[model samples]
Target chain A: MATATVILLDGLAYGMVLFIISVGLTVTMGLMRVVNLAHGGFAMAGGYLAAMMIRAGVPFFAAAALATLAAGILGGIAEMTVFRPLYRKGELAQVLMTFGLTFVFIAALTWLFGTDVKILPIPSYLAGPVDLGFRTYPTYRLFLIVVGLLLFLLVWFVIEGSLYGARLRAAVDNPRMARAVGIDVNRLFTITFVIGCALAGFGGVIGAEMLQLDPFYALRYLVLFLVVVAVGGLGSFKGSFVAAITLGVVETAGKFLFTDIAAFLLFALVFVLLLWRPNGLLPPKSVA
Target chain B: MNPAWHALPWLLAIAFYFTAGGYLSLGTSILVYILLTLSLDLALGYAGIITLGHAAFFGFGAYGAALFAIHVNADPLLGLVVATAVTAVFAVVTGMLILHTQGVTLLMLTLAIAVLLAEAANRAYKVTGGDDGLQFTMGPVLGLFRFDLWGQTAYLYTLVILFVWFVIAWKVVHSPFGRSLDGIRQSQARMRAIGTPVWWRLIAIYAISAAMAGSAGALSAQTTRFVGLNTLGLLVSGIAVVMLVLGGTRRLYGAFLGAAVYVVVQDFAAKVNPFYWMFVIGGLLMATVLFLEGGLMEVLDIGRRWLRRLLRGSDPT
Candidate 1:
């Protein structure tokens, strides 16, 4: 019973982090039809920036916020400049270019901060244990759950309830028709891409403890993020939410139960699931 | 135009032997990289198999050779044959399972194979030496020319093997089967409509490419006497892609130029700072994809055309 509870809470926290990091990749892939392999680079950028700021005497939360915003700005600039040309290119070019960008990001990070791992220290309030009615838990885990749920709701409201959400959905379903119906799909992509980048950055700063922050952070955790996106289906936000949770629980369970073969099992599961549903569990109507 | 030009690279290798006092091993590794890239071109450039996990076979080849040396026989030739055979068989089985899937799924599956193999190797530490890497000494080639302290035998041995593979690759690219592969690359459906067994053909080429890659891996292990876990890493596969792309895919000699340039640049870049290599390679990759689509080969072709026109003093129609 104790193990179950621990696994559940930890898995939920991990799932939230995965969702926050990978949702952007799914969105950008769906929107641009380009495999942006450098998406993790933005996440790493945010983590490194936050680490730098925190080390320079800024409060942790403020540093995280600033870093998230900076990541968004960086993403926007990248989308406008480097990513713009990719829209018309083939998959080969897209993969090659984005993968190249990842190397550059790693190089820059290494040049700036050396290759040592950096950690983001949580405040005392968040670091301490909190008493649940049934059991005691770390305050940080609970905080992650709350923050993740709130962010989910906010994203849900934006993507489902708002008029902008309708337009975005239309664009995702069928971009040509969406444009024919007077929706500015390009601008929609930019807005959504920026928001997605910010979310990844936010995830980076918060999830750094579990994922770790180093020069190779971008490429190191790439497989995990890509798996989340793949399992969740490329274009579905709610799908990513569910997939992240499931993968988190399965991974956490595997870690405790089958220590050596956990990664192998997870990758094998991806292959099986893909074979079962090539389009993913929850695919959009007309995936480009 | 001149058949004599074919021997130029071999000539350079023979000259490099005496002149390059301390860099023979570097030359040997360059030959290995060249072989790896050439194998990748056969699949990626010719057959349109977009894989990111070619390093898996390379790693398998290395492990197979290393283990064979340690346990079975220390004969280099026997180990090479065993390693290549095992890698090709593995590729055959994997290709059967994965060649049906196209696009994103195919890409992910290929990557998964490499990751799973790496993980498996990491866990079986006793055999693989885990992250510490596997080290083994082997008998000299045919018990004749021993691996010398100066690495002269290793360089010559690798060069001869590279030349053999290069000839094979050249012949394979110009053959009927290679043309069929080109058709499949252009349109798998069209090839299928014409009674071509698309999946089986892919499997065949994949096995051949794997065999070549495995041979390179075996060569690396035999020459260096060590196999690092990084032989199976995504970085190695990514570097192969960069090298092949840089040299120009579809052009047989691209691997030679790409490997040489990449190694030279990497040597210089690493001297400045360890991280500078990444920036240089990354910048070169982007530039190649965006501007120099045909890679340095296109530039060379244009130069050749200009030179011919200049000498002839007229349009060379």
Candidate 2:
């Protein structure tokens, strides 16, 4: 029971990080209809930026905030310069271009910050174990869980409750029709893209401790983020959240229980899940 | 297609032996890439199946052949056969499961399968030697030529295999089955309307392509006498795609042209600065997608047309 509890907490923390990172991708993929394989590049940029700031004796929180903003600006520039031109092109072009962009980012990062893994200097307060009534848990993990929940609620409120989200939804549903209705889809896309990138950057800053900041971080964890987005059903925020947590727990538990065949079991589980639901776990209602 | 095009690969192969005999290993590496990219063309170019994890089959074949040689027999030909068979089975099973999906979902599925295999290989270090990879000596080629350090025999052996497989691919693509695949690529709905067994055809071609890729992997393992986990890496899959795209897809010769250009450029750039060759590759990919629509083949075709018009004294349009 004790082991299970520990596993559950660790899995939740891991899943929360995944959710924070992947939710941005899910939104952008849905809104833009572009694969954006370079999404992880933005996260890497944020992580690296935060690492640099913290090394310069800045507080972690302030550094993270600045990194998020910088990542968003970079994302905006990319969307305008690189991605905008390819929106009219096919998905293949988008994929190829983004993939190339990923390489460029990876190479650039490697040149700047050598290949060694960069660990974020966690604050002393967050480094120690905190005593819960029944069990002692790492403070940083608890912090991650809290942040993930707050971000989830914030995203849910923005997407489901706000007027801006309504417009975003309208644009997603029918870009042509939304434009005809004077929704300014291009502006809407730009806004959503920036927000998505900012969220990814924020996730990177927070999850840096957990996921490790490295030059290869973008490519290494790309598949996990993609899996969450794909399995969650594109454009569905709730679906992404649920899928991320579920995959996180399952993967963590599988690794813990089956040391030898953990990967095999995880993939088999994904295959089964995908086979059972080809469209994804929670496909949009309009499709049916 | 021009008759000269059919003779291009052969001419190039012969030219390399006489002119660049010192770089036989590089030549052999290019040939392996050609086979791999050609297999990719069979799926992506012909069948219009966008896969990002083709290295799964390639790595499987490499490991299978290496393990077979270490445990059972070292005969390169028989190992190639066994490797091809193993990958064919893997492809059939995976293809059946993954072919039902389309677009990004299919791409993710393929990537996942490859990653899964790579992780499995990493964990099964007892058999695979883990990250260090499996190193084993290969026996003589067809009981005739011995594997050498200069890679002369390896080059010729790879060239022959590549030539043979190229012919098979050429025949397959030109056949009615091949035309149906083109039809599917163009419009799956139209093919289905016309009574084509689209799913079955995709599965069949995927398996065939997997077998071809397996042979390429087996060839690499045999020639290099080393098989590493990177064989199944995303980088390999990505490079194969880049090569296919650069050479131009659908055209069989494009695989050769693309592999040659990419490998040669990579060799040169890596020699210059091993750490930053990715910049060159990435820049090239961007230029290809943005400026060159149909890749180098199309550019060459355009140049040929211009030359013909100039020779005829006709005003170029």
Interface root-mean-square deviation of model 2 in angstroms is: 1.5
What does candidate 1's lDDT look like per residue over A1-288, in tens digits? 888988988989998999889878888886567788899999999999898899899998999899999999999999998888888976677878889899999999898889999988998889999887778899998888888888889888998999999999999988999999999999999988998898899999999878999989999988888777776777888877887888887888789889888887877787778767766678777852
Q: Per-residue alpha-carbon lDDT of model 2 for A1-288, expressed as tens digits?
A: 878988888889999999998977986776687888899999999999998999999999999999999989999998888888888877677778888899889889888888899888988889999997788989999899999999999998998899898888787777788899889898888888898898899889999977888988888888888888888887778878998999888888987898677767777777677777766788665332
lDDT of 1 by residue, B1-317 (tens): 45766777779878988999988899999999999999999999899898888999999999999999999999998999999999999999999988987766677778888988898899899989999998889898988988888899999988988899999988998999999999999999999999999999999999999999999999999999999899999888888888998999898778888888999899999999999999998999889888988888888778878887798886565
Clashing pairs in 1: none
- For model 1 the interface RMSD, in Å, equals 1.1
Candidate 1 C-alpha error for residue B256, in Å: 1.5
Restricted to chain B, the TM-score per model reads 0.96, 0.96
